[model samples]
Target: MGRELVIGDIHGSYKAVKQILERAAVTATDRLIFLGDYVDGWGQSPEVIDYLLQLKSQFDCVFIRGNHDDLLLRWLKTGEYTEEWFNHGGRLTMEHYERLPADKRQLHILFLESLQDYYLDDDNRLFVHAGFTSLNGVKHEFFTRMFFWDRTLWETALCLDKSIGHNDPLYPKRFTHYKEIFIGHTPVTRIGETVPVQKANIWNVDTGAAFKGPLTIMDTGTKEYWQSDPVHELYPDEKGRN
Candidate 1:
């Protein structure tokens, strides 16, 4: 089997995403699992989605839903924008879509609608855009929103003792169901790191592509990783998410 590669949020940093993919030497045979937040930050949200759609045609790809993506979908369906969404880089995404042809816009909307809340491989490696609230397997219908917004699961993981065995009650209940959990949405830059970070069994790969950090991608088995240059460097003229 090809390598199983898990990627963090892109947040419309198409240049960063492209650089990381090249650095990882991604092949058609590799399985790519993208943790969401694909849009709403940089100037290339539409281009990022376009590239992703092309990638799906060549690789085994799994796309996760994220809070920002949800906001985009909500606006696409209702033609309404919440203040929180517009203020947080959503305007850039809207501008990109508005410039596209009607058919192309619909295609991107469908792509966002088709994103999965989470993915679990046969090896018990779980991939989610954001942390899930329940220790149980993903409840897509009931906790879909949480899958894109929750952070407590990661905070709990960071506090728990990793040496504890799964059977131990002292072990984090949130991690009991999976061998490893890969996630994005909570950028590692918040902890002053610009690279993928591991806390217990959870791997946080988001290096804040929406802000001024790199984009990260990692091999699920070998724990090897690759990253783009700081996103700000890629688009020197843009203000990004400030």
Candidate 2:
């Protein structure tokens, strides 16, 4: 079977993504699953998307849409970029499209819309940009949170609390069982932070590259990880603190 690597949220840190891929030494035979939120927050949104598209051409890539990606896609579908989007890092994304020719912008917007919500594997692994559904079918609270959401699912699993349920059935059983879940969105001070529970299944790989930290990547089967420090500071205050 091919090796699978899960990557965390990349808020337009194209260089950081490149560096992490380099450090991981990803081969064409390997599968790289991105947890979404590929654009916004930092600059270089267009450049990052371009790189991801290029990677998709060479490697087996599964790009799941985070809330931000979903919102961006929704906006692009209407051809209406609103003020709410601009206020929450949408300005960077808008600038990315504006920098390109009109035709290219239209094409890119379509590309964003085609992304799916999540990627699942038979090996008891599920990759999402944020939390899963609650028992009532309501999305986890983090789905509405700006940017990537917290690792609350992991915490709830550790605590064995059913009240933490989301509307999404994907989360309930997995949370109860010890399945290795790879997610990005929540920033961590270290390259990889394991939930410190028995089996320690949850892995948080967002090293805050857009916020003056390193971008991270991890191999699910081997438990191996790689990271690359920020090429330059994008937002000093947001590093690992967000």
Candidate 3:
């Protein structure tokens, strides 16, 4: 078996995605776990999805679904749009899809719809687009929303990392089940870091490719990582969801 790599959000920055993949020297034997948010933000959503699909054919890959990807899937299925999604980079995704041929668009939609909410590897590491609420194993009937929208789990993990409120009896026990957890919805850039941030056993790898930071990918076993150049520089003419 090859090394296991967990990647941060791509957010339509195909250039950054390409950069990280090349930098990591990903091989066909490597297991590539993408933390989601493959679309929106940048102008290359279609290209990004295409590349991911192509990458899937070449490597062992796990694709998780992010909130932005959920919105895109919903729009594809129902022709509905949420103002919030649009404001959060949905418009660019729509524009990219709209320009694609109908069959190609349908294929892309199917790919997005097939994404997993979370993935638990054999090593007990959990990969999710966003953190989950339950510390117990993620339930089959758990609300899909929590898979891509929960933040309190990260907060609790942060608290645990700082040894703050560890004595609080009410703290959730679910987080302790995994050997380590990797997530991407909440960007590390918000915390002034362009690299992966580890709070307790939870690793936040979304280094804000949607804005000004680099795209990140890490080796699950080694904790070693690689990042693209500042993503904004890769697409100099675009605003990129800012």
Candidate 4:
């Protein structure tokens, strides 16, 4: 099988991202898939987006759209509602760009809008930002929304229900086709939080780095996991730093 390393959400913590990649020893022969949320949360949205775009040009990078990314895209498109966007770590995103000049900000906005929703490799591995859809009964709309909004999948993972939250409105049909499904969006305090469950080939790599948890990376084929220190230190006085 090919070398495939699927990564979890990166909320603009460049340090965490670098550590995970270095630990995984990613190479040209290996496929690196990011589950999305590449921006927001932390203060490096501009840097993170620029870095990912560059990596896409040089390496095999697959980026799926996360809810924050989609909201950021919308904010850029029409400058519409900003509550939900900023409330969920969008403040850092704005702060990241507020330091940039107009031209650079426009360039970054263009880059953000260009990201795709999902990527499927020839291998039986699927990379999605959120959870998967239900088998045979749900519509594409449901799947699309869940891709950016589902959280039950993470709970199931924590509960060790490997079925990948089959009860979720978004659990996909027939996980048998893929050897594993790489997902992000849920932030667990432990890497082993996802060790259980059947029916869904899920390998959740979101360790809640932005939430004082380690950033996560895992090899889809080998299921090897790696973690990096949270970019910023979390203390009792700074409970909401991220």
**By lDDT, who's the top model here?**
1
Overlapping backbone residue pairs in candidate 1 total 0
What C-alpha lDDT do the candidate models reach, one value each?
0.89, 0.66, 0.88, 0.68
Q: How high a TM-score does candidate 3 get?
A: 0.95
Q: Cα deviation of 226 in candidate 4 (Å)? A: 2.0
C-alpha RMSD of each candidate structure in angstroms: 1.4, 5.7, 1.9, 4.4
Tens-place lDDT per residue, model 2, 177-202, is: 43565666655644254321122456
- For 19-42, candidate 1 gives per-residue lDDT tens digits of 999999999889999999999888
Error of 2 at 113 (Å): 1.8
What lDDT tens digits, residue by residue, belong to model 3 across residues 159-235?
66354443456545766678888999888887788999988778999999999999999999999999999999999
Q: What tens digits encode model 4's per-residue C-alpha lDDT throughout 1-242?
A: 35777777778777778887889887877778888888777776677787887778878777778877887777766767577677778776776666788888788777777776667778756677777556431234355777777766555545554444646655444454455666777665544343212225566677776577767777776677787765555223333334
Show pairs that collide, candidate 3: 135-174, 135-175, 136-174
TM-score of 2: 0.76
Error of 2 at 203 (Å): 1.9
Q: Using Cα atoms with residue i matched to residue i, what is each candidate's TM-score against the true structure? A: 0.96, 0.76, 0.95, 0.80
Residue 215 of model 4 has an lDDT of 72
What is the lDDT, from 0 to 100, of the residue 39 in candidate 3? 88
Off by over 4 Å in 1: 162-165
Predicted structure with the largest TM-score when compared to the true one: 1
- Candidate 2 has an lDDT of 0.66
- The candidate 3 region of ten consecutive residues with least summed lDDT is 161-170
